[model samples]
Target: MTTIDKHKPILVTGGTGYLASWIIKQLLDEGLSVHTTVRQKKHKTKYQHLLDAAKQSPGKLKIFEADLLIDHSFQEAMTGCELVTHTASPFKITGIKNADKELVQPALQGTRNVLFSANDSDSVKRIVLTSSIVAMVGDTIDIQNLNHGVMTEKSWNTTSSVNHQPYPYSKTLAEKEAWRIASEQNRWDLVVINPGFILGPSLSKRTDSTSISLMRQLLSGKFKMGVPDGDQAVVDVRDVAKAHILAGLTASANGRHLAAAHQKDFLAIAEVIRKKHPRYPLPEKVLPKWLFKFVGPLMGFSRKYVERNIGYDFVFDNSYIQQDLGLKFRPFETTIEDHFKQLVNDGLIPDKRS
Candidate 1:
């Protein structure tokens, strides 16, 4: 019932990010005017890919500077925007020394700041918030207690804390805060796209993305001896971007939409890479949980995380995004294939030809 005004600009936060870059590209491909934000205008060089994406597309692009911690930083970009895809949030699992300061505050406050801008805007009617599957379940083991051993939109991460699983904890706090704020408003509706560990081609060559870093570590034989039993609910980044657009434009789309495709472990990921480059030193097996439990702490993961997540299978029910948004997920093989190809093309990871 809802049809977005194509002429009206859509605002996308975190334009230079791996996932956000894909979202912005799709919007431009659709010939929709997109206004995007980065931390500062001086960093415009990082967004040349976005500029290039718009070159052949009919869509118009505008760049703005905004900060997550600064109040009203997103207001100017969001002005006259009927849909604001708030994709600006930190995602990091390793090297987090201060959870609250480094992860939680920015996510919580960035969401708050964006909502504040929306509340003041007369044009914004809906917000498609980018949340994660981690916000639904604290650990892979938590899904075992679900009704059908599948994580759903109804799930809430109760196990994560600022100390343990702080990244998930930050997403949980931010999504919870969003719901709290939306309850007090009437003019706008909030739609959440809760995707899993997003994988696939990134438009930019930046190495800061958590997914990119993980991909690099895997392809570089960092875990050639063996990878942990950790599993991921994989979803294509392109599909995730489509979910945001559908959630914004589809009038009937409501509540949280789980945007994942498959439930596979780290070994499965390595196997997919091996198909293209078998000679590369890819993991052939998973390390024993008992052994990983001891070495987990040495590799940035806490002993508690090892106990709870390792040797567990995490399954998710993605029926909502598919049925509601009419989203068709890309194959896992395609996701990994395109991702590795992009990395190799950019020399982010050298292509080894034997």
Candidate 2:
């Protein structure tokens, strides 16, 4: 285990992101000074909340400007930091016009740039990467090929590319690149956290994250007709943040940790919200698979892909995270309720059914 004093000033990339913000909060609460990276230092006003938190806590906060694609952009921020948490990665399921330029290139290049900086930084001891469960298995259909019913850290996403589930493909390649680089050197040990769909209260008012956008769609009646017959291995955002810190400080922590809760389908998620906040118009029915055949294509989803994925079950063995990092999960119901309450309080959602 890492001693409190041995933990040097940490550097967190993508500090403004929905998940990374919580990681910063936990670290600061422990009285550890953190140096966070942003695209522009002039965006200092962007992280005023973090500054405010630092003032009340015993820790300190420093800001630096770094771009994922730009070479040597992270050098200054990485200097003398003992630990680095690389959390910045593009996450968009739609509106992507170019797969290479938009998804793949940046992810691969970003891993290289950050790890190269870690190699040069003498003070850095470990690099913890924020990966996703997407890297563990590509799609629900992949379960047929495995002997075991569930996915574990030993599994790798073998069937993913820009043509299908491109987001998962990007994460697979980026994480592979991280391991490839780490194997060549001995300066910094690498640890990766592969979390499933993250959901919880937001640290800011921004609604750009896909998970948050899903909540917005639910409240706005975007899918009032019905929802696709799909399920997600959900994990709370705060739990994921706690896992990251635990992995960083734990001495024997040296591999991937799958931070996920029990699997739940769309109807399951909607049911939970409906119970807590009956005012919200949560989706009630599962759209017919045949109807999805027509509507899926219009929504930029391949009909064949939907047919293969819909109504399938995918399980994850989270014992590794529990036993190794000593992670305790928040009840899935609690996370759902917390996020829904925050939504109503923020005025982004109404207290009555739409």
TM-score result, candidate 1? 0.98
Name the runs in model 1 displaced over 4 angstroms: none
Candidate 2 TM-score versus the reference: 0.95
Candidate 2 residue 241 C-alpha distance from true site, Å: 0.4
Native-referenced Cα lDDT, model 2: 0.86
Candidate 2 lDDT over 1-354, as tens digits, reads 343234578888988899988899989999898999989777766777677778888878898899999999999998878888999999977777888789988999999999999888888888899999989888887866776778889889998888888888999999999999999998788999999989988877677888988888887777788998867889999999999888888877879999998688877778898875677667899999889888987877787678777767777789999999999999988998888877878787767734
Best by TM-score: 1
RMSD, candidate 1, Å: 1.1
Go through the candidates in order and give each one's C-alpha lDDT: 0.90, 0.86
| CA error at residue 324 for candidate 2, angstroms | 0.7
Per-residue lDDT tens digits for candidate 1, residues 212-295, read 998999988888879888678898899999999999999899999999998888888888888768877788888998888888
